[model samples]
Target: MSASQAPSQPVPPSWKDLGKAASDILGKDYPIHGSTLEVKTHTPSGVTFRVFGLHDNKSSAITGDLEASWFDRKKGISLTQAWSTANVLRNQIELQNHLAKGLKFELISTLVPEKQAKNALLATTYKAPGLHIRNFVDVFKGPLLTSDAVVGRDGLLLGAETAYDAREKKVARYNLALGFYAPDYAVALHALGNLTTYSASYYHRVNADVEASARATYDSKASSNVNLEVGTKTYLDNAAFVKAKVNNSGILALGYAQALRPGVKATFGLALDTLKLSSGSADASAHKIGASLTFEA
Candidate 1:
């Protein structure tokens, strides 16, 4: 040994150092900070209420919404009303098990009231008796506008769901989606020809408390982008849970949730910017931190 090199001096923890460490681990992806809070309660008479709040760090704004829903078990119907900070009100009704035993069918309708325009969304879901296959149709009415505002036309979104139980406790699923103008539904004969997008996913149980899944999707229109995401969830002791996710773009995120009490919980999340590491730009590494609290009674 040329004289045992002096032990490297330990570096103190600093924001920059932390950023560099995260950059080294994550590679090129960036994260933006956001947070949410939720509270839910049920009255003795069976009425349920929920409130949600969200915060955006970049915008430094907090927005909230509230919803009250009640289910009539005897009638298999649910009614809900939700109001958001944006002055939008949504009234919804859901009917479950609307059909006899031959098939299981559910229908849901939502009406949104706004000063600019009134909108409605209707959806129907059908499931096989044994729950092996499922199908759905959703229709949106009103002035539906895209970013370009060129396709501000009402449309119907049709989809089908099918799953296969693979060997060794693995499962695979496929979802086919199609979108077309509501006026053209009759002319199209509800064809699957205009396949707008489709997604495939596979899930496996790593163990009783852990599961992993991967999903890939492709869009035929709207920029024609393909996305892939892989994630895992682990159930920890004491009503705690953790999740980790990585996207095809190399972004990584970790989330932890802890139950503070029987009806209260807290959650924390961290996302690392892996992309900056690949480009050797640790200074530009963008990491995010978010936290939320939830209560249910």
Candidate 2:
């Protein structure tokens, strides 16, 4: 006799399962994507060639200046593509070195990053317990002696990161963090809290450089939809610039990063950037701000 129906058992889903689902969902849309380069010249066909460069795994922020040059043997003038190629290489190099101490070295070439349709979060984890650092620059975890995976129980995330100036001196201060979410607590204890709930387990970082750090940031949802971060950072040694000399270094930062959709974001940031020397001989600073729209990965 044919069975009327096949046996089916309902499977139990645990916190781990839920966490995995969350991670998978979030990891698909990371904020850090590749950069763009634009240069203007006199000629329409002035563009000789373009090199889609990648991080040489040696620099950070700026590309390495290696193949940083393009030849314009015909017109004896460098074209737009040539200039762009230079910046790309330089930017790649800079990014690699800056993140050297961090674990973003692999960020240079990754099918995951190129796959714009899918958000990419590292699937690796710390075989042993470990800590990580976070930074505003690259969109990846730091040199994780321990890895930070997508999902976990108790909902605690631990990480840290740092930033450097053009002179290769560490300037910005970063602290590893722990994010905790007690879903049960939210449901049983509180009712007005069903948001993408997350709270810092802890945030701490100390800057040893000569410059003082003055910075603050607020990331909240209901009571405070404010995203305010400002701080000052100085250098320990006197750093020099082209046609300019300075004895001090400091940065006043302000930014707001918020969610635009379930897995998307809109970001805006501005900073007062400067390099000052102790001798009071040189001073330099610039006003900078940028906007970025991203997916939550």
Candidate 3:
């Protein structure tokens, strides 16, 4: 009788192992898509600082320029939380009396007290109508631990809406952004509108007492092949507070982005973004800001 061979034990797929394997093959494609850094100094303080920049992709952009501050005085508990607000309204005025059509605006807020908000959005508004049969996939790694995979049957879409406050390039003190496109609004509404608090934080960016924030965006015909885009994004560590000493975030930002190509393809806007934090005061607050972008269905 022929000896029967023992069945080989199936190896359970480990996320980290799978990630490494994927990285070995795909080559870190999501986090390293091309991020720019800008210098925004508070002239009054004479403190020259730099902020990590964001990409120009619609469907996967959310919030921008959200930095955490430190509040010395605490009401009761020695809470170390802070917040800031900046109003941005960019219009195509004229450089050398020339007409430019890159009019834009955004408002993003963030803070991390209890920690618990973690997730990254990638790929949006990318496709080649002429080429056809395109595919896009995104994988994210952070505290909350969430994965974003966008499979585009036409081409690839990319986006980045990030505002980072970092004294150093590698480490950002406060990272935030808000992007609005043609596809993410509905998802945000569905996600946020159904929760008891509707405000959920995974890693460090959560909503504590008086925690509330929002984002919006807009985009026009900015691509020849249906306005394709590519960009990258990253988030900082989180320390949030959930239930009774459950350890969670102190602030949180919830929203989505989309894209709408006028008159050509079925005008499909995709959405993907981030979840961050924004502190209010040393105490008695958690989150703030309401933001959204873009103009179209």
Candidate 4:
């Protein structure tokens, strides 16, 4: 075959990310009931630092993270520490390395709140043309294990995932999914929660500046439990965008994000209970408002 006629390479996403397209459109960037500020700084030496602060009517907290990378970002170490005004502290460390062309490994350990026995995890991932696999195991305690695999060809995908509890000597959960990905649109279906819950999602790029998505879920165990959500994202210009979504329970959410400068951005969000609004019983406390500021350099 001529060079121009060679088949394009296949790159399949992981099973856990089967519905990420729709989820990203329909569920992401919609804050709920709080305010957050984040700042990040990156240095030429492959080191980065981040700080986060959150506040609400009743509580406030701060968190910090640091990361260092080497080998062209193929190897890295990161630590996250968080503190709350209530005198709670949490800390975690992660180490990552690329072992081979398509294989990578990670170790995660929680250092604070030492009473937890299963505070460490081992994980690995492998990816190649048309295939992806991921596995995770507990470093202590029951050694719980989980694995996921996905295969794709011609834009069609099939995937499965399972979790086993070694201490319980049983299978904890299993899930299956099917997906079709195209340049302009994507669809996904999933059987989750041991096959008791089913969900479907669709995402479409309406135009250069507009995207839309929808998702629905049904629970076989509870016939009355059904959920549906639809959302849209529209880019106003190069530096600003807006998103809106509504769910089956009559909750409406709106978010607006804009870039303030080269390394700064801000987002504002609001959520309202339409049902309560229509009934004339909505109060300030019945609605949620949030804002976020992010800085990166």
lDDT of 3 by residue, 171-217 (tens): 22221211111211111111111121111111121222212122222
| Best candidate according to lDDT | 4
Report the C-alpha displacement of residue 270, candidate 3, in angstroms: 21
Residue 83, candidate 3: C-alpha displacement in angstroms: 6.9
Candidate 1 vs candidate 3, TM-score winner: 1
- Candidate 1: give the clashing pairs: 26-274, 27-274, 27-275, 28-274, 28-275, 28-276, 29-273, 29-274, 29-275
Error of 1 at 182 (Å): 37
Residue pairs that clash (backbone atoms under 3 angstroms), model 4: none
Model 1, CA-based lDDT: 0.56
Instruction: At residue 192, give the lDDT of candidate 4.
Output: 97
What TM-scores do the predictions have? 0.62, 0.22, 0.16, 0.88
lDDT of 2 by residue, 190-227 (tens): 11122223321111123443211111223345445422
Worst 10 residues of 3 by lDDT: 185-194
Q: In candidate 2, which residue ranges exceed 4 Å CA deviation?
A: 1-126, 129-248, 274-285
Q: How far is candidate 1 from the true structure (C-alpha RMSD, Å)?
A: 19.3
RMSD of 3: 24.6
lDDT-superior candidate, 1 or 3: 1
Q: What TM-score would you give candidate 4 relative to the actual structure? A: 0.88
Once superposed on the true structure, which residue ranges of model 3 sit more than 4 Å away at CA? 1-18, 24-35, 38-50, 57-63, 66-297
How far out, in Å, is residue 127 in model 4? Answer: 0.8
lDDT of each: 0.56, 0.30, 0.23, 0.81
- Backbone clashes (count) for model 1: 9
